[model samples]
Target: MSHIVSIQTEIRDPVAIRSACDRLRLPEPVFGEVKLFSSSATGWAVQLPEWRYPVVCVVNAAKLAFDNFGGRWGDPKQLDRFQQIYAVQKATMEARKRGHSVIEQPLEDGSIKLTVNVGGAA
Candidate 1:
């Protein structure tokens, strides 16, 4: 009795999606055109373990939409994983792009300490 669920999100970058998948140790994401509500959009497909269908990620003008998905083979935890991995990847990319250094430390509490800076060299 599981049905498709469309989970809206703040994710828009295809590169970030790819990075997220990499963090999960899953297969590379598939990217191309997708059908949106009233039109078609192009983005990537997010695939988690045991999911028969992938969530369609469509980006338009820097906005991302996660189309309705997750019928029977979907785990709600996958969305959490995507957010976590995407954040790390996006943070690292932005920091480096700003000519800064990034350091990620995994805490004993299972959280990550992400530090970014120019190390006062600026």
Candidate 2:
């Protein structure tokens, strides 16, 4: 009924993972090399729990894949939330890497806009 979707994220640093968790405020511990969940995954996985089929993370691939047990790849709402937080973290990391300062501003419509400033003349 469910499906597996591999989400290739820009998430490289474990610290970014911690920040994402903190930003979303997950209820339980979703850490370590790998983990599994029954509800909507806040962390990441790519396995369907079953009696007829068994799946597991057997390789060390640096990625964040979440299992969709809701008969879909994932819940749109939850995935959006994850994307929002992940966007900020990823943008910030890239901005800093390019020698720019990243600033996040919350808009009236409840959307965050990232502004990067490369100081030099302006």
lDDT of 2 by residue, 16-41 (tens): 54565567664322343453455222
Which regions of candidate 2 deviate over 4 angstroms? 1-9, 27-63, 71-74, 97-99, 107-111, 120-122
**TM-score, one value per model:** 0.68, 0.51
Cα deviation at 74, candidate 1, in Å, is 1.3
The reply for model 1, stretches above 4 Å from the true place, is: 1-9, 33-42, 61-72, 108-110, 119-122
lDDT of 1 by residue, 12-45 (tens): 7788888888888888888877554455656776
The candidate 1 region of ten consecutive residues with least summed lDDT is: 1-10
Best by lDDT: 1
Q: How close is candidate 1 to the true structure, as a TM-score?
A: 0.68
Residue pairs clashing, model 2: 45-65
